[model samples]
Target: MTEFIPPGTCFLDLPSPFPMKRGGALHGARVAYETWGVLNASRDNAILIVTGLSPDAHAASNAGNREPGWWEPMLGPGKPIDSDRWFVICVNSLGSCKGSTGPASINPQTGHLYRLDFPDLSVEDGADAAAHVVRELGIERLACIIGNSMGGMTALAFLLRHPGLARSHINISGAARALPFSIAIRSLQREAIRLDPNWNHGQYDDERYPESGMRMARKLGVITYRSALEWDGRFGRVRLDSDRAEDDPFGLEFEVESYLEGHARRFVRRYDPNCYLYLSRSMDWFDVGEYCADRAGNPGDTDTRAGLAAIHVEKALAIGVQTDILFPLQQQEEIADGLRAGGAQSEFLPLPSPQGHDAFLVDIARFGPAVAGFLERL
Candidate 1:
């Protein structure tokens, strides 16, 4: 009989040492995940949700809790995901600071926190870890694999690495590879953390964390995650306090500046700096074409189409936001085009939203229909 895991957060311990894409292996690695709905006897009505850079396993509320999730707007009994019909599983990324094994987790080898010592992680590693969870649940094939941002990259890696694992794929604001501009922005985020005095080369004491650097890094990230169009429309030279003097230089003069600071402060309290470094670097190194090349005769070639051509899913949907400067629409177009070239039924939907890359999270009205229609067709 299949072990019944209730609808809530749970941990899946890897039975043996987990191998990474780079050299070395992780011992006692565990993945934190959450499930919603019920799996039928066949265990085929399953959808795996891969999160972006910072989400935990809690994708949506369940019987145990009622709090809205990060993507709560699009996940519910009657939402786009419709938890009542499909068994949904969301896994926290491998190198995240959540309940999953990460830089903050204790290293079995030395009985100390891994910190920067955690083995380098890749998008493929995240996919492999999630795949293990699927097998542990006795699921042979997934109804669909859904991903956004970094999660989208993980979905691609899963499709390329473990062929026929999923019947369909839904990629939202994801890319085949990290672009140079995104890499450059993330590099600055990492630098901010490293430059902080409290960082101490990633060896700071528990009480003395690198809050300033992490805060600044998150501030920079917020800027890139949205577009200037959004800022102009939402905050548009609006002062935080009308009574404040226009010449006040020491305090936050604009509403946008305060907004960024608030988000950064909240992020620093929840995320570990080293884990951020590892996850960000992992995204920078990801290339679906590289994974595709491994199956081809010449592994060194940079043929993106050849890599995309390897995906054998029954259907695929790639959604892009017009103002998402981070991932951009061009990358989504390429993904759709490549999948079609590979003989898979593919559709590309471009959405116009001032929210930019984060439209999938907040602009549910536009994203929900597109996602729901695709899943319905599958």
Candidate 2:
């Protein structure tokens, strides 16, 4: 029912009737973005960042927004991303509720909310919109394009669909395709929202919003975002104080339970339910292997090798956490091997972090250095 647009964000008007990867098109649609540092005289020091499912374009505070951002620690002057040396640009995904055209946005022709009526969204569509933003800024080629989580898939799509767009890449906890387990998890999350009475087939207003469904969906995501090792070491059956305990038998009793409740509450209203369903299914439907030229021959078999080899880049780095379950370490390895097979000197680094899929966000010590080292060499 609400769209969260960060302060000091900039907008780029996409071409009229912007085509979607699946079907349909968007007219007078715009993408939200923010920038740091100055583009060098050569205009070649640009690095574009495509974010995960939920983050806004405000990756780190810029001149217009002084408040801290989601990746504040890793992106700033003298930080791993190092705004001092690079002209950094971060764009929110096209189909996200965060300041981007999505199910939460208005349809120009109908003068009403797009909601489920919005055209089918795909990760490749996000990639295409981001490419349009890049070209609009007069940049011919990017120095590097960084993608995290779902963004990693978008980055790969950007590279393949639009060859020679960037010279390097950094993929953190990203995958070439959605795994069955991940897809199942997202499927359950979507089901939770759909089953909620307040969801009303994506017709609910703020007063009757699907709070319970969103809470459950977010709780499921938080569970998978971190590893069991971290959960055990952090909350390990710790009981809440009697005063903090709930009267209901199934109410929050453990620190982990309280944490999930608080986390879900904070996120429920900030994102649109319909947007969540659209984006979640987008990831499930994404299969980079489908881009391989021999698709007709392969039939149901999916192999990403040929598709990965089709992308061109001078160098690449695929980072993964050993504890990651959603994307897993094998996906990072697959990306690295794929890039290397394409003749880009690529490397895969798997960190032994207990933070799981969210290691890139919290375990900055490892991810930060790896990212900085790769850029330094570039």
Candidate 3:
């Protein structure tokens, strides 16, 4: 079992309505999150960083006796998320396995891991849980809510679902809806895990986990999370090794294979395949329009511009990387345009980087300042 205790943090046992999206009922659910800095008496300094899929709430700090966090370069005492100037909190998403309610959580009815028994999750529900966390922190309003990828989707959900929750919003490389092409690709990844024999229909015990299936899923995800240009430049179609192979495909067939192997190994070890499947599925089903309704309730509320104008946020920032094909620059532009059309104070910048969708992590020099500059202005 994964240990629940992380150093210097507290777990908040949050309650959820049983059966969530569809199952039956969960007696209770817990959300494991960590906070840095301190909330002033007025509680106006809180900044929430909702993580992307598959990552836990350990956003900054060396908590959980875990390795340096995924975004440590940009979140520290003097970094972009500056613990010194603002109170920062990161929470595991509602459907995540890391001390949050998900497929791995115990099902009160069956008394086993939810697995396939878990109710389906939606992006709006995920965002609602996040809003609950912020409220639990006694933050009536937020300085900003920042998110990336699926986290960005959740951030949008928060704004759409709760019109005035935050004074500012920052969505990086995300869209209002999942593109059909993206859904098609993610479906293949889920299939890779489901087809694995060792998956045992999500009933496999601890000792008999589906490592190979999980690895395949990670390999497939790595392909979509980044750009083809990145792959070509980083790993051209080179030989397996320095020496020629005697018709041997046993070793690294290309630099891309080696790159994928390292990525696959790490992801499989750190993540749960069931969590991967469920979260990816939730992302595929994500659409802001799903929550909005027309007079007939047939689901065609495409004009987010009016909603943006109605929001009472004081300031906001929207950013995108030039090479982020997964959520291309146009999406960020749309968000910025909507905010401006709504008369909200927001700025949009598209950073030029070769790291593609991963630029938010690798292109720190550019992003670091952008983040800092935005927060500083606020």
Candidate 4:
């Protein structure tokens, strides 16, 4: 069934008022988004549902290409997101091609694809655009802003950039800054794309779409998202396709390789190459403290422990999955600590799962109750 979308919601595409990181301004800076539930008269029942990389505004609805929405399991009537009570909004980030302004869009000046010429996007810009969306929707304040992975980073950025925008935020599997190891991994992925002759420096207008390179990059990303322990337990030494022939390749002759290839193929088909490069680069440059020290623009100064101590909240909960290697438990703990220090009611809970960073999607039984309990108390 098509993911249920509440009635009377509208999609908005607004122009960006600022220049992009790589120079030039977008003429019609479109942001694909969806809204659900009612505004509760006061509009305080709104929840900003931030998305991870690649997915679009169809966070909980059927997409144009018959694709199931990303967070379908968690977003419906009476689900964790509870569309019946809370209004929700999800927008495709600025640099994504999934119905958002990105390299795939036509450049107004040249009337051609932006491609490599598309400017770099930052998480801050994502936050800024989201803030604009909320405002355009006539929501003065958000009850909570929830995000995962890059979406988590954007949520944190929202807290930092627009103080008091969200009463609370739930960030899942993300860090304030991308680690050096992450940088190296993304660099290698970028190399894979650039090395592919078909990429043609992001100028490929062909059908194949650097599939091999994109697949390799997705494989690398999947490896990092999980851990050796999980991979070993799930498919250790398993035969590929249940049997291998003499002509079968050695590396992909294993079940795990096939599994990774499946994920890569899906990712490559759904996501764009230049968008991947720009989004990965945004992650690389996402140090919360980078612009904060100068005070010109604080990207991580939403409310430090000392800063939060002054405010009051009914209740708060922070959750981390044990198998999530991408954003370790330590990062979630740090967020919990910040909330507590800010004097808001808060607690950190860790749940065990084998799904790695994908645990949030797969292990919702545990997460659902935790979030529901916290919300109930509030």
By lDDT, the better pick of 1 and 2 is: 2
Report the CA-based lDDT of candidate 4 relative to the real structure: 0.73
lDDT of 1 by residue, 332-374 (tens): 9988888888777999999998899999999999999999999
Q: Where in model 1 is the C-alpha error above 4 Å?
A: 1-8, 242-250, 297-300
Best by TM-score: 2
TM-score of every model versus the real structure: 0.95, 0.97, 0.90, 0.88
lDDT of 1: 0.88
The sequence of per-residue lDDT tens digits that candidate 4 reaches over residues 1-378 is: 011223322456666455664456777776778876778998888889787776677767532323446777787679888878888888878788776677777877798888877777788888888888998889888998887888877877777677777887776776666767778988999899888888888887646478788888999888977877778988989885655566855656778888998899878766788888888889887765554443535554542343323324434456777877677777677667766766667788888867777777767888788766665454
Whole-model alpha-carbon lDDT for candidate 2: 0.92
lDDT of 1 at 358: 92
Reference-based TM-score, model 2:
0.97
Question: By lDDT, who's the top model here?
Answer: 2
Q: What would the per-residue lDDT of candidate 3 be over residues 91-209, giving only the tens digit for each residue?
A: 88877877777787787777877888777787766777778788988998878889888898888878877777788887777776787777887888888888888788888666788
Q: Give per-residue lDDT, candidate 4, residue 220.
A: 89
Give stretches of model 4 more than 4 Å off.
Answer: 1-10, 21-23, 62-68, 241-243, 248-251, 296-316
